[model samples]
Target: MKEYIDRKEAISAIREYRGYFQDQKSTDMMLLKMEAENILKDLETFDIVPVVHGKWIYTGKEMWRCNNCDNEIAGYDKMPSEYGVNYCDRCGAKMDEVEE
Candidate 1:
């Protein structure tokens, strides 16, 4: 049977693999790179800050919210193309044309 792990377990597994790579002499570079990429993707999904240009940047995935009612619309890519001009469902206020 296949096993499933929660986010915490997944993150822990990634960290453990990284440590193993550091200690082992015969490391698989391609597998290490793939794991690194997976770790980054998981971190982003949890709204964790990621390293950028050698620095940990405090930026999460961009989210949209209704200006008038403070209702959460959706994250950047999930938003509709016409969301900029749409009205808020809760308050009937026009959506903000500009992203913060």
Candidate 2:
């Protein structure tokens, strides 16, 4: 399961994790260290709060646009989700009408 945490909480957890490695060593530790640092860097660049969110609105005969980003998305007459798209490919906004 994934836990959503604020910056302070995440920082605290990372610090605690660093402390746990003070005395442990594994043959694969060196290999994983770089990957772990990359993961942390990726976390640091993440947007905890999304800036774009909304649904696709039918704009014309076969055109649909994301209300949040105002970009065209390809889909049939049904909701984009009917075609297995649960997000705005252009803006990364979830296609759900409500946020979880």
Candidate 3:
């Protein structure tokens, strides 16, 4: 979880997240927006602490781990347009980029 000091930034973050959810075109966004708005509305009353979890779950992206050095690289939404993508970060080992 991350903390924010500014309330406007927090609201903007939630709105941007709402956009991401809306981009998926799922009805779940309606419920999510309700929840987010509720949280924002009560921000001043209940200490305003927010926690985001589930980072431990493995998300399917082209996440790479350098086998030789154990360094991890988060994948971008689109694959790089140039060259083979096995270039390593640490020992310069050409590692496989696994989905998830």
Local distance difference test values of all predictions, in order: 0.50, 0.67, 0.52
Is 2 or 3 the stronger prediction by lDDT?
Answer: 2
- Separately for all candidates shown, the number of backbone clashes (residues 3 or more apart, or on different chains) is 0, 0, 0
Global local distance difference test of model 1: 0.50
lDDT (Cα, tens digit) per residue for candidate 3, span 1-100:
7454666666677766745456655667767866877788776633654322111112348554444565566654433223354455445554444446
Question: Candidate 2, which segments miss by more than 4 Å at Cα?
Answer: 7-52, 98-100
Candidate 3 Cα outliers beyond 4 Å, as residue runs = 1-4, 18-25, 45-100
lDDT for position 70 in model 3: 57
Alpha-carbon deviation at 21 in model 1, angstroms: 97
Best by lDDT: 2
Which pairs clash (backbone N, Cα, C closer than 3 Å) in model 2? none
Error of 2 at 65 (Å): 0.6
After TM-score superposition, the amount by which residue 58's alpha carbon in candidate 3 deviates from its true location, in angstroms, is 58
Candidate 1, 1-61: lDDT as tens digits? 6333466666566655655457455457447756765865665343433222111111336
TM-score of each: 0.27, 0.49, 0.29
